[model samples]
Target: MLTSTKTGTFRFVLVAVLMLLLQACQAGEETTPAGANAGDETSTTASGTQTRSDEGGTDGRGGTLVVAMTAGNVPLPDIVPTEGSEGRRFVTYQLYDGLVRWDLSRDDATSVPRPGLAESWDISEDMMTWTFHLREGVKFHDGTDWNADAAVFGLDRILNQESEWYSASLGGAIATYTKKIDSYEKIDDYTLAIHMKEPYALLHWDLTWVRFASPDAVKTYGNDGYIQHPVGTGPFRFVSMEQGVNMILEPNTEYWGEVPKLDQLILRPMPEASSRLAALQTGEVNWAEVPPPESMEMLRQEGFQVLLNNYPHMWPIILNLQVEPWDNKLVRQAANYAIDRDGMANDLLGGAANPAVQFMYEGHDWYSEDGTTYSYDPEKAKELLAEAGYPDGFETVFVVPSSGSGNMWPLPMIEFLQQNLAEVGIDVEVEVMEWGALIQTYRPGFPPGENVGGVMVSTGSYAPMHAFDRNFASTSVPPAGNNKGLYDNQRVDELLREVQVASEEEFIPLMKELNSIVTDDAPWLFVVHDLNLRVVASNVKGVVMAQNWFIDLDTVWVE
Candidate 1:
């Protein structure tokens, strides 16, 4: 029998309770997919253009919307946020605009690159050089003109270590996106060219995360002070913040694009699901992110909108390849087979997620049909384990975060998987840790604890090329990139190099092939893709809930 040093009975009970509640509440009502017009109606804008309005039937203008985030601590309002992806979702995306941005206006399976600060761009024939045409008449919140010089300054802050304003801390967060660029220069007031070390086809997608900040504000506030008083060219302008409590923003009337409909946007940090649920019930906040799974039906019944949509997110356990048995491919494949993804998705998450067979969702453009399919087959798992010379499966430890952004009910989920893996003879000891501490393990040189086999974390599979490179590239290991697992495959590495220079038509097939190889290798235990759940008051309007981590909030307003 598989034995665990850790007691997970309480977590198992919590999962059981959630499952029972979900079974009782499931009435065949499917989650609203991205792009679906749920409670939306057609309305004409002040400019006489027809547009969709939120359920409240208003012009989506003029109200304060307060949202409770999953972070326990409020993020520093800077170019690189402090609270992992949650910081980017709540703080960075709101306060800054990249040269390129995700097309968050539509509800689609995939969000492509759209113009943000840069109105347009061009690429050289060899694809090694890119020239961006900045939008004229745009000014940062600090009243600094956003010209090519400002863009170069922003790039140097992350890419050039010799620059006085360069930040090693912020640079690490964006290394993957900025690594390929050899250098950048201000060609003119409105144009800049980024010269790559080699041909890179995914520059546009990578640039989406390379957001620019006000150069003048950085100088005045200094490096550390800039985090406190951030200035950017986004639709929302920073107003005030109360440390770990809340941060407030107001719309910029001089915004080049559409101004925010809400007069104010307040973001609060509430890590507990119960706290978020209670806040929603008491009308303390207009929106709550990642509410308790069992409470979704109740929230909907109470006239609140329980929103769920498909996004490029996956909750997986990144195996430590240097660890014993995990170094063996058969043992890794067995663990993948041991997982019961459907039960975890439908039962525990209340259908708020989809089972992940590959890194990408089944219907995604880059998802590979040729990849190995990991079904819930305990017998197959046992057979594979026995073949790998461990008829009686081995014991290992898993480090998991109790809660965080894109991490959906991790305790219950891990407990459920513990039971499934135990049935297949893989005894797992669970080690729970804080989200911030768990995030530290993702960096280079973080030692895996004694007997540690894997770390459970959620990762984004959006930005196809970057995602592949970050997770599977050998060069991406630790200090260099996000390849935390230290997985190395010669064929995979070769394919990655080819894809960087491949033609647009050749890219998809190469990615699909790479996906197949990685799936077969089983470097990580694939679990499920989150449906991006949130609860909003019925009075809240014009929330698009795009199929992305980021959303356009300028269209949102309180009714």
Candidate 2:
């Protein structure tokens, strides 16, 4: 039956009462595949531009946009404590909003930040201190007043190294400007001043991710508080969460902006690739994240919707530079030249992966175009191996995750690289481990001499400071989470620090230098930066997709 609802006002009375009823119902079985008629039959373009019709409707009837995701197994927090699986990001966006959202209007992938909790902000001439004018008449999901103190509490909690939410990446750079935060003083009830130790240009955008929590919710929930009962000044309100099962988010009635049209949002975790796709196909779920290429093609061909957007994330081969065989620069360079990235992008990934020539993607405004790019040459690889004092090639163990094409998982691409390395006399013993175990095994402390050697890791970067400092910094040895391979270089470290403070012109040179050093050192065979395939149902409307992962559900409506 085709039915529609109006946009703007909130729907459903006694929504909280029905939350338990929805939770009680188990996730539906995989949907049966319908024939390919799901695609739009009308293929007319506007002025020669063949664009997908943006008529928001997946099914004729509308309610919630049930999204199937792999993150079901992983217990994600409502507010992001640190760098985590992409699934966790969905919940984070629903609970908290950023200061200035990614401004997608800019060509350079700049964040088009709209006023969230803060109405306006002013930067000092010296660029040391920043004063934020908070928006009055805002309230958390729990009905607590949203004010400057709430922002301070959130920052203080995350910045504190002792707090579990304190990510090492944020701590490294944010800690440096601790002197700037003289105090989180309330100028009035709606204003806060953040004094800085030094000048930080990206402070405004930085506040976008810096979340604030309600004091009441924290005290009530305590240590494990936000998990079940999260409160924030966002478009949606947290209803309930069942461990290892599903999460439910309802539209916040007091939301200051355009209210979400859907009465509720249901996120069901379906880890298996096939099952997730099946759910999307049968209309059991409206959308799914990171569907397999085969599934994506099937769905697209059938008229199902698909969205391909770039992300500031990469999947690279992590080389153990501290180990003996790989420690040789020639072997690293040979391995770099040996692997076939183009084949991986087109074949294994099904044309979704972008070949990563440098550490950062061209999408990132700061990426260096003049950086070195190692081409695929089997003969050159063999020559370099022979020059590195290993004429007969060397044997090593290669580890990868058994799940997820993007992270902790092995594909046909791994098999190809293994074959390519074999041509140079390098024998690879491939080992498949669960994703969590793989992460733990590679993360710094593996006992003194307990070397696991080589593994394929998917490391993501959003900011340059952490990208350079944590991944390639000299002092960033293991256990602290910087050096999984325990690799270190003093010159690279100097350049990283220099780039952090350097102007746009100076930073480009430093970025180029960093790339050249990594290329020469050969610690990793730089692979590809990925583009996330976001599938929104036809009924869902109003979202600005960009390279950065910031999503605004408030603007989304069903009509």
Candidate 3:
């Protein structure tokens, strides 16, 4: 991955894997929400998911756990997202706790919601009201009680039109859920009720991102001021956050659960894979994300642990369907057929990622064989472009983030895309941009792709509901969600809603149907499924690596 600069556009592959992780989106959902049978479901250990050190069965005690990672670019921007993207594995996840947390350890990360600030919850029968029983004695670092009132104040801020997050932002991240709240009612200090405008199937999953902030901190620090001294009720209390350096966190000794095993957790931004690996080699850091692909084998040979996990991540060549040429489905199909998805992943991503035919990764529960229709076919691309009245290829701008999670190695991905598209007479002028600013390009109106953005090159989600809602769903528009390409289909909108409300037995088949629809529509140049790889020093133990980007650092410690 290339290092972060305010603005620069060169090329590489590791696309959106880290940037758009559902784990960090931090939003919530509805129905007389089905209650998680907390008595039996609440376990310290969840198989293949985040676990306490005692539950994960790792041997380690206490020590500083220095993590070489992406920076928390913006200092405590808006814990309650207004339309923004932020990194969490480093520090935010440490400083705050949502009603529930994404179980990063699970294969089906979105399948269930793990307990966090909320001890347990029950859904009303009508699927409209969700009642949460707050964990007793959870206190923010500022000594503010975590109660129904606090939850309401924080959440209401995100929903209220007067708040900067609500007006100045396009927060499809977590607001996808918060926007559903008709209102929240306090049952008692320890109990709260969240009523939705409609029945939402993944209500709990959505709540995973609605991180509660301390009302006291907000009142004292104000929005911008709080960024300097944020407070939360998580295992790690925020000690200090320097914008581009590192976020230092110390154990929350008064934490409700067992105190973190690490004396300090340092999340430093070492953007380049080589620098991170060098840091890991020097013992300057114990763990790092997305090591240089070429060095993986060497690192492992040197006794450093390299870990790989696959989730529902895809790197698609997003096309602006609202614009001409691209509005032609045939053109879209040709673009999909022209590129060798497998070749891109194999050559550029160090074979870490898989060629994607649809939204989910291979072997995923909702994965479908039918979606694998596109393949590398330059002749086919030419024919389609000709049929669309473009006997000669067209020219357009390709916008890619300067750096992302490194799933598809975006920079190289775009260059490769430029090469393939040119063969069919298309000329692409590459533009490198930062993600925070690039996101603003996703606006409504025809030829929307021509102005602010045409191609938002990056990796995307394996999260079915959130993925559908964010990319193809009608509501998932810019200033709302990440559907920057402006792909809108009523059927897709309906299917997205259908699958969410469907029971487990009915969801897969229905989801597959939706996949077929989107595949046929060809809204994006389906690229490949991104892979997540992390390298850890030998002494680091109990590291619960979640498929989505967030990390459960509390369980990790150096020997």
Candidate 4:
């Protein structure tokens, strides 16, 4: 049995070995022309070898770049992604432009909000009213000018129920992010002001999800038609789509920002990790997301660039507070204690992850040093279960997605957890569902089933307030928001409210306190944080491995 300290040492050694392997593999190879222009800083690894180019320039820009996505089905290109974050990463992000966009041009840290369609913004003294200055001379893929009316029109599509294009599903998906916005008014053709219900401090972060589509396109095509022919002011424009197979996009030459180097971008839905790996090996795809963990070493040795970075991602079993034994905090904490996160991270995931001590990874600004840490202790787990009046243990079902987005080997990881829980007298019945279907189960309270304990899903804690509010706030339950677990504590609600209005200096301490309370409560079985991994073909150039769930493709080019 490896102790936590041993697990840390093992992870460090594993990373060192991987770095060494990468260096040796690329030693005498010809330096690939990075897509960086003159005067731009090219990034180099520890061995001083060029890895990616910053916003310098494009090396070659006429090739088609095909990427294998983890999603089983192609995401509908729309403002709201039906397939969850995976959909946003591959489809929506390429076809649409948000008010604020993630800074995906760098790989050094987690992405932060940068100006997109909106050039800059200002907030009132009370922080209730936010005015945005739209970018000039920007047009959607459809050639419609992007102005304040278009921005308000896009907002109404998801925010206003009375609007013609309002979709209950799309609106529901974005409600948590835009919950604070009470109304919007056009100050001018290129200026907009959003009036909030309160002094919401995370409005800028929320704006990243409030993407805009061409209002004329939506009206001409209607909701269903627009999905097929989505038009936005993004670097890529929708070209064609074949559901469950592939969606092709072409470069938006008139893009407001950096134009995509590739002439075409093809996103293929390949749910099976083996299929994705094979595609990368067979030259069918230049990039593959989340390759099989077991194939990492072989791929690295075979000259594939296996990129890894620490990101704000986690895979956890969110217990239903509405369910029987899971309703007890002791039972939840016991389950966390029973599982060997270190084993799962090191042995099962091949050191592609780290044990999660809190919602955010260690060293994150919001990560709490005082938070509860659940070590591998079967005895402690059994004791807690007995105290919770489940002396003989309990039987429950854990629903998990087949494959999608940041989900890292769901079946094997869950099975490993199933065995661990069984040893502590908990019988966990595994239930696997497709990624899209599993995402649908997130709404409408607890999933309908007999003795359903929880659901294993990958979630991101990119912003502390957004994460805590969407997952734990009582107001976020059901059709209102994404509190899938139905976790409602008054203190949590209060703290979330404070976070909503917390100042820059006050946010961290408040979140730390909030994290400590949630960690102690054990609302979910804390699992492992994903070390965002992907495999790119050797010929792929200028691919910045940004430390976020999403990636920027504008700079990437194929040799």
Candidate 5:
């Protein structure tokens, strides 16, 4: 979760020098060059000696947490383009705190939204207005007071038509957020009121997208300058970012909440699952992202901890409704029925994933289990395809990402899907490209003449209704939004609009109705909802993989 312009060797050298300087100044602190080392048990720095604990964790204390992620090092994280912005959230989530944050402690059975920068909120009886009571005395990373004016500045940067974000990709990516809010008003120095154009069903979910960046920092550093030097109110303060290498984050001891236990948090972007797993195995890192499925037992046998947490990630084979046979309802239904989701969940994925029931999987209060979840009916699939005039099936590209945790193993998952589809006479040629390229190919008009319509493997969203806004809403079509399938149903669009304004009591049923309608339309081949599997050094403690896709490293301590 770190970023910067310098990459490759220069980034490495700069980090080395900074680390060396840190070591010479350490009195009892552990400052070492090998803090970023990937394959070693003993790492000695300039100041103190640091050794690996065989396999344990201890009470919260100051140490260092080195994490390897399966993502590219992004230069800057756009708060607007929350989806498919690569490693931006990984950086921003730690560097900045939102007014409302998904309760990471809640399990898959419950969605408990937590108060963040704004300690409390009030919604009007009509549900068109929301008043937020901001946390008093909160300060940005630069030691500036966090008040209504600063918060409004960040919101205006996104909402104002003349702002830089409005003229570019940020505005387009966040179209889902913009169309809902009419305007905002400052009630007091610490209170803010949000006026909605209409009743929005999930204002709390939408508020989660906002993170108040310091107005002073933005004005002083400008747009490009802010990317290099991000300032926020989170526990970790940004130090340096070396693209594709490492990001250095030092603890903000003056953080408003519980102080971060780690003295230095080093985030390394390896992008390769094998490399990330290798780093965890060698004791170079305390935590890591997705590891190779085959390495789980090996890692556990060697005293590492392999945890599979149920995350709010849904893997759907996005069906391009504008394309060939997919345009037919029967053919789309056939695509859904053709694959053995249970088999994929159990055999191919080694039971690390669950067969999906709907878009808003369990735990979300608005989640629906009433949708018609497809069963593996090979005969039905073939019969439907024959009825749709694709008796001999057709050839199409199954676009997948080469990196990231969309699927446990994207290539293997594709192979399994390929095999399953072949059983029903559908031949799939898997196109495994970079994560960024995969995202572009699906969006409406960015890549020009590319064959944008087809099957795209795996999509994830932390906010269920927001996912609908981007994927199913009328406005979310290419170039502006990520409605990859170009799926638009009059009823669905209407229900989504209603869902936005529906109160807490009215939200679930509306979402349920929407889910049933969308699944019946078959915009996507409903696949398995993935479980987020991670490998960590046994010495790593308090590292919880929240269903909201956050790795809580603040409490993580080295034994």
Candidate 6:
């Protein structure tokens, strides 16, 4: 097993031995509206498929699988969503699997189109269209046969305006390359096809996130409610959930693919980093995530196996341009010059993070030029502020997540910024709140000028292009997704739109130009690209760790 340590509060679980069995499984049903459920008699299966006692007992796999995370889980919706908060990743494994599985082994750790519901795919010469071939004999956990109708039904729910799907991070750019989506063809009982308006290189990658769910189960549970009791073709089934407490899942023996060895998975919410580490050491929990430079030494001494890999995640400090002072370009530029990126990377991150110069990482192959890295110059910051009419600087409150490394991890950077800005006479106050509430307060609908000067630091696995535009582009603002700063720039927006649909050559120059603009404007202080610290037990084997870390479940086994 592996182990590591860092400080942050965040919160995932599994259920019965295989005793229950159902002769008559759920059948095809009408599509369920995103979040509507009025005592709907959607569908139900008999509890006679397998004995409950044998369900989560043991699959002959000896050891347990434990994971530690820095973020907490949110409510899971019934509709098959392409994107979600941190909690959605852990919960999705219990209910749905996409048409094509994402391949994390790629150079940029992107989702490569591969067989899931579709066995193979063909592309036209113009690269504007694609035809998919579905596999036969595929069935949902409810015994309903997997067909073209089910695939289209799932897609419809995500794209529907009333569904509130969290797919903007992945699907927001769909308006660009894809001018039209003709239809999802039911070639036969077992085949499916998708026709696009234009060539979208990213669409192939996007399909890896199109997970399928039982339409009947969703109608019964309603949107934002099915997560409590999910039904999918995966190796596990949802049993129960206690809000803010724990979640449980049991193995699905009738799973078409190789069933998981573990009979049960118990996901407990440990909000405090200290408690999470203590749980693993004392056997209260089996696994957890570790932040670098903080918990590295202690976890290593405890004989836990540590895993290191390139994670497609970034940590940036946001400046809300929608508010006063920041709305002024000179004021925003002064804020950028006031911090030391190198110092923050070396001291706070303990060299575990890389100082970012652009929206994308320096390590990516497509990355062209390194943009300007602001040196720690309090004099220059003062000059810029004076030029912007704030000679004595200004005061504002900075909001950060109260629990976990999200808030605590940025203390050093905050301290540096405070000291530098204070030299120019700027006073700043810092406030902390839980991750969930923090997200709600910072979004677009949350009133203008409220909590305008704050930073939200987070790390997760995602393709760089997707991560860059999602965080910086104003068009990505929620309810679309991740545009917390609410920054709007016509030129920057134009560049992002072009890059989204551009080929590799055209994208490189546009990306470089975009990075230069953001650096000059300074609406965001691009912090470090962190390397995730993961620990596994020695008894565990075949652990396939990916940049996202979520794909580890596929290869993990007990020795």
lDDT of each: 0.79, 0.59, 0.65, 0.77, 0.65, 0.54
TM-score-sorted candidate list, best first = 1, 4, 3, 5, 2, 6
Query: Could you give me the TM-score of model 3 versus the true structure?
Result: 0.85
lDDT tens string, model 3, 1-559?
5444544444332322221212321233422222222111112212332222223355466888887763315334346421132254455567788888866554333334566788777677767887888888889988878988888777766776665434234233456556567888789998998888887645766676677778888778776677677788988888776766777889999998767888888767665567778898988888887776677778879988776656555677677766667788888888877877776776666666677766565565455777656768889888988888888877766666645444334556677766777778877776676554454443332233244225654544534555677677888675566676778888888887776566645666776777778887888888877666677877778776455656667677877
lDDT of 4 by residue, 366-453 (tens): 6788778888999999999999999999888887877887797887788788888998989876667777767765557675664667
Error of 2 at 419 (Å): 3.0
Off by over 4 Å in 4: 1-60
Model 2, 421-475: lDDT tens digits are 7777887766665555555556543335745457777766544444555577655
Considering summed lDDT, which 10 consecutive residues are worst modelled in model 5?
12-21
Which runs in model 2 stand beyond 4 Å of their true positions?
A: 1-62, 72-74, 81-83, 104-115, 123-127, 161-188, 195-199, 362-364, 404-409, 439-448, 475-481, 504-509, 536-544, 557-559
lDDT of 1 by residue, 122-144 (tens): 67777778888888999999888
Query: Native-vs-model 3 lDDT?
Result: 0.65
**Top model number, TM-score:** 1
Residue 257 CA displacement from its true place in model 1, Å: 1.0
Off by over 4 Å in 5: 1-59, 74-89, 164-167, 360-370, 445-452, 455-457, 503-505
lDDT (0-100) at residue 492 of candidate 1? 91
Of the candidates numbered 2 and 4, which has the greater TM-score value?
4
Q: What range of 10 consecutive residues in model 1 has the weakest lDDT sum?
A: 20-29
How accurate locally is residue 150 in candidate 4, as Cα lDDT from 0 to 100?
A: 94
The candidate scoring highest on lDDT is 1
Q: To one decimal, what is the Cα RMSD in angstroms of model 6 from the true structure? A: 12.7
Regions of candidate 1 where Cα sits further than 4 Å from its true position: 1-53, 445-449
Q: What lDDT does candidate 3 reach at residue 491?
A: 88
Cα error, candidate 2, residue 221 (Å): 1.4
The C-alpha TM-scores of every prediction are: 0.90, 0.79, 0.85, 0.89, 0.84, 0.76
